[model samples]
Target: MAKSEVIDVRVSRRVLWVGAEAYPLHNIARATTIRIEPDRMAAVGRFLKSLLILAILTVAAVAVIGRVDWPSGSGQDALRGVVVFAVVMVAVFAAQLLKVLMTRTYYALVIETSGTPRAVLVSTDAREVGGLVLGIMDAISNPHAEFRTQIINYNSTHIGDKINQIGGIGNVGKRVGS
Candidate 1:
């Protein structure tokens, strides 16, 4: 992802300005922070399935080779080929598992307007997003309140909407087993 621009945020005279998008404070019914941890179970499951298939194929190949008669020197050559293929498959599986393990967690400042809730700012840094949430809450009640902060718009979904969309956390897509 590209670097995020330093967004301008100000809440004054009942208006909340996030970058160039201005929202009236009254329109914002609620504001809160959510910690979004990447769901990796699906990726892990795929890796496991691939490994299982590879294991079965390797066993089948060995069994067939042992039972079959080949040209004087060809049997050993075929076994070597199987060994090389298995090694490459294992390496690919390991790389996939590593990628899933390295996925980052995200923190977001979500604001619920009269319509659906939206993620206005997202960061990998929890403190930055948490502080922004508090500032927004303060601005909601205090018209004179103002806040300024920089946020990195990391790749993130609207967590509030996701909770509702997936029928709340731990129920479905976010976890391994419903």
Candidate 2:
């Protein structure tokens, strides 16, 4: 139960954890190389719109083909129209495939902190190639070791202070030179 029993360890750029404890902290970094051009979602919207228009056009084309008199004439023209429709369908599928490929280029990084019984902290970060970096410091033991709650409370306080330091938010763990 003493504070010294608990420790926080950072395994890599994506994972952080409290040692000798059950809980873990998770952090994820996203791939940033793939750039999203202006109105990136616009492409997706346009693709969807094209699909809708194509669907309506296809229904109309089918209706027209069904109504035409095949035995008398015009069968050739109808067949040509169907071929064109097939080509359009293929184009739509290709566009969708491209969108998916572009979207997948982005990556994610996750960090998790855990110990003996359970997880303590979990966090996720998404950024471009120059993503945010996190650092972990060694854990300090609590003098009140008998109570688990006291140990957790002390560790939590220290962890918060460490996080603030890592984030450049405030000074932490400073001792007076009295």
Best by TM-score: 1
lDDT per residue as tens, model 2, 119-178: 232222123112322222211122221212111121232443322244455655566574
lDDT of each: 0.80, 0.41
Instruction: Write down the TM-score for model 1.
Output: 0.78
Deviation from native of the Cα of residue 95 in model 2, angstroms: 3.1
Clashing residue pairs in candidate 1 are none
Query: Tens digit of lDDT per residue, candidate 1, span 81-133?
Result: 99999999999998988887797877877889999888787778898878877
In model 2, which range of ten residues has the least summed lDDT? 145-154
Per-residue lDDT, model 1, residue 158, is 33
Per-prediction TM-score to the true structure, in the order listed:
0.78, 0.31
